[model samples]
Target: MILWFTIVQIAVACAAGLFCLIAGLIGRRPSDYTVGSLLLVELLLLAQVVIGIVAPLTGNPPTGDLLEFWVYLIAAVLLPIGGIAWALLERGRWSTVVLGVVAISLAIMLWRMQVIWTVQVA
Candidate 1:
């Protein structure tokens, strides 16, 4: 994993989470802006996944438990995905709330991933 990119990802997730949380708490429904931001986050995760795969091939494998790191990566990608579906189904401020929570969780998961990557070398 690229440390710099991971840091940027965390920042993006946190910022997005705050945006969603505020929108949700203010009684606002989902909007294109929020949805677009969510999509951006998804795209970034996809990029991270690619980088993760390539990093190992290039001899930069994590020093930690690989399976655990993989699990975190999968969850980080999936949580927001599930939240997006739920938001679409629910169609209200609660949808944004779910997204907000997902974003926050994703950030934490990514941070853990960073730690795992750095601590456990191949």
Candidate 2:
């Protein structure tokens, strides 16, 4: 439930999304650079996952529905992985577009996760 970490994750997702979208617009297929950039995001998400898991155990559970927060975290971790898998198989600019869409979705998921974490306890 660290707010700054979630904010950084959102920023990274949006930046990655824009990068992939620009690559698609320029007629470039998914490449090492795209995957590498996504890999960074994936790594950050892994850290987030670890944090999410540990926080609850250490007395910092989300203020809202913990189940929903976990679901969002799972989805956030999977999106980049699925996108990379698709790109590897498709090997086209369309794959880049797909990745861009996934990255944008990841951003939304991060935002949702933050909201879930910060909901007022009642």
Candidate 3:
């Protein structure tokens, strides 16, 4: 796991979470902007997955237990998938709520990844 990339993911997740909270407070739905941001985050995670796979192949120690790493990766990817699905099924404040869930889940997964990476390194 690249430290800077992980940091970036954390920052993005926080920003998305904040947006979700604000939208909820204002009683507004998630907009195109929210979806776009989620998509961007997903894309970044996909890139990270590719980099992670390549890194291990190049002789870097695997960042964590392979199964744990894969679980986190799948969860990260699934957040946006869930977000998109919910967005399609609901509108208004409910959409924002769905996004909030996605953001929080992403944050949790990223933190877990960090912890696992640390354990592996140690």
Best by lDDT: 1
lDDT per model vs. reference: 0.89, 0.88, 0.78
Q: What is the lDDT of residue 29 in candidate 2?
A: 98
Candidate 1's C-alpha runs over 4 A off are none
Candidate 2, 31-115: lDDT as tens digits: 9988877888899899999999898899887888888888888888888999999999999999998888888888888888888
- Candidate 2: Cα lDDT at 24: 85
Which pairs of residues have clashing backbones in candidate 2?
none
Tens digits of per-residue lDDT, candidate 1, 70-115, equal: 9999888888788888888888998998898898888989999999
Question: Candidate 1, residue 10: CA error in Å?
Answer: 0.3
- Which candidate gets the maximum TM-score versus the true structure? 1
By the TM-score metric, which is better: model 2 or model 3? 2
Superposition TM-score, candidate 1 onto the true structure = 0.95
Cand. 2 TM to true fold:
0.94
Cα-based RMSD of the predictions, in order? 1.2, 1.2, 1.8
Query: lDDT, candidate 3, residue 36?
Result: 72
Per-prediction backbone clash count: 4, 0, 0
Report residue 61 deviation for candidate 2 (angstroms): 1.7
1 versus 3: better lDDT goes to: 1
